[model samples]
Target: MDQTQSSSKALTLARHVLRVEADAVAALADRLDGAFDEAVALILARRGRVIVSGIGKSGHIGRKIASTLASTGTPAYFVHPAEAIHGDLGMIQRDDALIALSNSGESAELLTIVPIIKRQGAKLIAMTGNAASSLAREADVHLDAGVTQEACPLNLAPTASTTAALALGDALAVALLDARGFSANDFARSHPGGTLGRRLLTHVRDVMRSGDDVPSVTPEASVAEAILEISRGGIGMTVVVSAERRVVGVFTDGDLRRAFAQDIDLRRARLADVMTPRPRTLAPDRLAVEAVEMMEHFKINQLPVVDDAGTLVGALNMHDLFQAKVI
Candidate 1:
């Protein structure tokens, strides 16, 4: 065939594959019945983690399903069915739930361990195409992930079937997440290295500049002195405090530029006279993302971090949050 004809044929085949897979997932939505509910209930009632076992392409899907379940408040882990027969079966507890995936419902590796799990009183949830298959008939709950046709031209590869299985697994995880009232904070705890984790888990005190790093001066200090502090601290702002160390006002680089525009004398002017009084501040326990939001809203860069009594304990700027990778 010519190059143009070959490219055209490839694109047509790709589109057809996508349509078949999409249809397979759509069909699963209708096939979801009371068995899905029973499967979810069984997993929820268990006091132990879920054990997922499968072989081949189903095993790859099983690993992803296990990860989604684990990250979404449902405790689960995947174990190879072949390994389950060779001492890995010890990982399954009597009260734990089992989700086994096999398109044919006849994987010898899966069959060899199902009986052992059943004798231990573990709840079994089967994902298979054939309801009459041995694994489906023996399972406590059966989720049908059958596809009418494979995306492959020969109808042999596990394409549409795997897509349906993955979608079904995601549905289960999301449903359980809603049922358990899992919050973003809870999710962050499970993914501490991710951006979501940094945003949700990192707090103001954790990233704020504390101790002498915070630029501060008494309200009686001159604008030149505050200017020196701002320059030395490199946070673009200096906090003016009362005799008791309570934050009273703030002087910033913007203030200096405005002062220079008005021809004000920095050496003689007191910061208390020119500084912004009662500037917005954040509690040290607040989330770093909250600080970012406040800065964005107020069009400011630095935020004074105070304790419960409004005493300046730390200071943070856009740079600090950015450096902490929390911005």
Candidate 2:
């Protein structure tokens, strides 16, 4: 074929492959029935972790499925069928559940180990294209991950079938997540290094500038003193406090600008004269993400951290949240 024709055909083939896979996943949604519910219940009823096993492309999809389940609250791990027939079979316990992935449902390696897993009293949940295959018939719960055809032009590669199986696995995870009352905090606990974990688990105290690092000045201090404190703290603001260290107000760069706009003498103007009294504040126990929301909602960058008695404890700004990866 000519260069232009070849390029056009490649683009057309790519689009067609995407459509086929999308349709395969869409079909899985329609095919859902009591079997899907049975699969979820089977997994939920188990007291031990889930063991996922497959071969080839199914193995790749199985690993991802295991990861999704693990991160979403279900304890799961992937084991290769070949490895299972070796010494890895010891990993399967009576209390555990096995999720076996096989497009044809007749994978010799999987079939060989299915009876052994069953004999040991572990429940089998089979994900396969053939509902009546040996693996499905032997399973305690069968999940039909069938697709009409492969996305490959030759209809020989495992494209659409893998997509359908992955989507079904996601569906199972989400259903189990809801059934087990899995909350965002629970998910965050399992994924402490991710952004959602940082947002949920990180508190104001964790990111706020505490003790001497927090800039502050008494209400009696001049605007220039507050300005110097603001610059020194690098947070664009300084807290105005009483003799007891109780927060009374906050003087920010915006406050300084307003003072300049009003032609107030910075060298002589007291902080109390230009500071915002009872400014928006947050307790040190609140989430850092909440601080981001408060700052966005109030159109302010800096916040004074306070205690129950409104004592000035710390301070933080948008930069702090960003640094903590909580924004």
lDDT of 1: 0.93
> With candidate 2 superimposed using the best TM-score fit, by how many Å does residue 175's alpha carbon deviate from the native?
0.7
**Tens-digit lDDT string for candidate 2 (1-327):** 799999999999999999999999988899999988888888888999999999999999999999999988899999999999899999999999999999999999999999999998999999999998999999998999999999999999999999999999899999989998999999999989998999999999999999999999999998778878988999999999999999999999888888889998778778889999999999999999999999999999999999999998999999999999887
Q: Which ten residues in a row have the lowest lDDT in candidate 1?
A: 264-273
Steric clashes per prediction: 0, 0
Instruction: Give residue 220's lDDT in candidate 1 (0 to 100).
Output: 90
In candidate 1, which residue ranges exceed 4 Å CA deviation?
A: none
TM-score of each: 0.97, 0.97
> For model 1, how big is the CA root-mean-square deviation?
1.2
Candidate 1 similarity to native, TM-score: 0.97
TM-score of 2: 0.97
